[model samples]
Target: MSRRRVKPSLYISVDIEADGPIPGPYSMISLGAAVAGRQDAGGFTPADPEEHTFYRELRPISAEFDEQALAVSGLDRDRLCREGADPAAALSEFTAWVGEVSTGAQPVVCGYPVAFDWMFLYWYLIRFTGGSPFGHSGCMDMKTLYAAKAGLPLRAVAKGTMPRHLLSRRPHTHHALDDAVEQAELFANLMAWEGPGA
Candidate 1:
């Protein structure tokens, strides 16, 4: 009997900036993704995040906006409305990039707090590109991962609480791609870490 080969998982660190709280009501103004690494039986192999990345600023789909949310990203709604990439085209290009980068592996989207990012990314990908390259379950939450590894309550875990060694040196700039690349480094570091005891 032949043993089936296990495909490695290509961890893509993703981040998104939106105009409001939810997908249909709000708009995802910007999106970013970086290939964190690939993991097989041997373990994770870190990637050069800058070498494989994707980013797009999208036109708002709705007129509604949240002043506080927009302030965090520092993206001009008026400017995006006039010059941003079309959602369909941007998402299609992103899907293609995901496929190209994970040709022989399964693609997984990872984020500092994956829920928010996944919500927008999945919604946009399905709404614009008809489906998602990562599927429904291919997501990893770095925050939750840290919680489990550190034996701490999920709600108690925060970047400030984590050891400096486990945290990436990259600054958490709000620019989608900058944050994505920064979190990619964090994800790689988390994967290689053996918890507080180690």
Candidate 2:
């Protein structure tokens, strides 16, 4: 008798730079992602941050933006409006890339405090491409994972409070690609980590 086979989960670390807090009213100016790791029912293994990656900058969808948020990324909204790729084309390409890299596995988006990046990304993907590579629920938040795994309160969790060993050596630059790679590293570390003090 043949047994059923289950596909592994492909954890893609994603990061986004937006001009404002929310999507639609604002815009996701840039995006970056990397394959953090893969895990099946049996086991898990982390992937290199440099492999199977995607990055792009998109034209702003709205003129309104938060100057503070926009300042953090240092991306010129005017230049992006003129030079960035169309949101539809950019998101479509990203989804296509996700499709190609996640063959034989379910693509799951992973991010640090996914509350923000996932929000912008999912909205953009659905709004522009009519679908999301990561379904409505296919996301993992590293901060939440760490807090739960370490038996700590969500409010008490912060990069500073977490063990230094748990963090990526990479700095948290606001640049989408750089932060994505950093988040990918952190995801891998968290995946293999046993817990605090381990």
Most TM-score-accurate candidate: 1
TM-score for all models, in order of appearance: 0.98, 0.96
Q: How accurate is candidate 2 locally (lDDT)?
A: 0.92
Lowest lDDT block of 10, candidate 2? 189-198
Residue 113 CA error for candidate 2 (Å)? 0.4
Runs of candidate 2 exceeding 4 Å displacement = 1-4
Poorest 10 consecutive residues of model 1 by lDDT?
164-173
- Superpose all Cα atoms of candidate 2 onto the true structure and report the RMSD in Å to 1 decimal: 1.5
Over 8-84, each residue of candidate 2 has an lDDT whose tens digit, in order, gives 99999999999898999999999999999999997888999887889999999989999999999999999999999
Each model's lDDT: 0.96, 0.92
Distance from true position, residue 71, model 1, in Å?
A: 0.4
Give per-residue CA lDDT, model 1, range 1-198, as digits (tens): 998999999999999999999999999999999999999989999999999999999999999999999999999999999999999999999999999999999999999999999999999999998899899889999999999999999999899999998887988989999999999999999999999999
